[model samples]
Target: MENFNAQFVISFLIIALGYCLKKWNILKEKDGEAMARLIFNVTLPSLIIVTFHSITIDSSLMMLVVLGFVYGIIVAILGLFIFRKEERRNKGMLGMLIPGFNIGLFAYPLVQGIWGEVGIKYFGMFDIGNAIITFGVSYLIGSYYAKEDVVLNFKHVAGKMGRSIPLMTYVIIFIINLTGLSLPGTVIDITSVISKANMPLSLLLLGIYLNFSFQKSYWKGIGRVLGIRYGVGLFFGLLGFFLLPVDDMFRYTVLIALILPMATSVLPYSVEFKYNQRFVGTAANLSILISFVLLWVIGNMIV
Candidate 1:
């Protein structure tokens, strides 16, 4: 128990360190981008391989995956109704923000620290569903609102997931798990070593990307998005806790997964769709802060 609390402190400090590094100009914004690339292409994939490699596959775990997809769809539909009165572009920009979870960067490290491989296994499957919605639904919404002709092709979604390094790694490991195949010991050792770097690096990246600037004009939009994201998320989480027959670990994972900060993808989506970047940045940063505090409070209550 002490170790879990200590892990939170260290994780928070690492994030603060990253923010301090940026403020002092020791790390530039481009450094954050580079760090992200390293994590996405290398460290994160390695971590996925390591986590998924030795786990026992369970039939019941599929529930997490299905529930993940269901949650995203539910929140997205909520966003649609909530933003129904706004202009198409405004609706699209705000609506896309509600569905995705920042599981890899934001949730993984803390979960790893506190819950070990058990946490990763559940969240990883949950993320599979989360990824589909993020790249598929969120992208379509953004592109659609931007007046782009976007088709929801199965192959297109699969191809997009395939092209993503972390997702690809996840698919390969999942196949191996299902087939009862084992990775070579040398391969496991190598990946496990590399995977150790993922947590700290991810935390650091969050700090680097955290922004404090806010435009007064966008405050209402930001509040609306945050309110929906956290409110709906918490409601679903508590509903799952009491209603689902799943064990405590499963319930804990669901609670944490649903309430995670905005997906890091929101920033690039804003850029690609030509929405206001500052607004997205502000909303995302605040979400990160909000999630951290909520985790601390909720973690104490439940754990």
Candidate 2:
């Protein structure tokens, strides 16, 4: 129990260090971009492979992948309806933000620290469905809402996910698992070295990109977005907790996932779609802070 609480504190301190490094000009804005690229292209993919390489594919595990897809679709529809009155660009960005969970860097480390490799595999499946929304659906929504008339290109969506290193690693690793082929120990050893960097680097990247300033006028929009997000999250959390027939671990995973924050990918999507980047950026940081508290309390109680 003490270890769990300690992990949360250490995580926050690392994030704070990243923030401080940026504030002191030790890490510039472009450095943040570089770090992000490193994580997305290299460390993250390695982490995905290392963690998932040993997972046994089963019907129950596969169900998490399906639920992940369904969860994203449900939240996106709700987000679109909730923000229907807004201008198209903002509407699309908000909708994208609501659905994608920050499971990779944010949830993975915390879950790993508390629940070990088994927990990661559960969330990893959940994240597979999440990858669809983050890499495909969200991109399409953002492109649709762009000021310029953009063609709806399904190929573009597929290509984006295809090109993503992490997603590709996930699919390849899972396929290998299904085929009953174990990753060579040398490959696992190499990936393990790179994967160890993922958590600290991810949190550090969050701190590097952290933007705390909230425009006075944007407060209303931010409040509404967060309010709807957590409200829906709480509703689902309770439903899965009391009603689901799954074991305690499954129920807890669902609860933890429900309360997770919006994906950091929203910042790039906001940029690509020409939406309000500051709003999305601020919301991302805020969600991390909010989710940390929620996860910490829940971990102590449930785990």
Instruction: For each candidate in turn, give its C-alpha RMSD to the true structure in angstroms.
Output: 1.5, 1.5
Question: Please, what are the lDDT tens digits per residue for candidate 1 over residues 171-213?
Answer: 7898998899999999989989999999999999998988887
The lDDT of each candidate is 0.88, 0.83
lDDT of 2: 0.83
Top-scoring candidate (TM-score):
1
Clash counts per candidate, in order, are 0, 0
TM-score of each: 0.96, 0.95
Candidate 1 regions off by >4 Å? 148-157
- Candidate 2 minimal-lDDT segment of 10 residues: 141-150
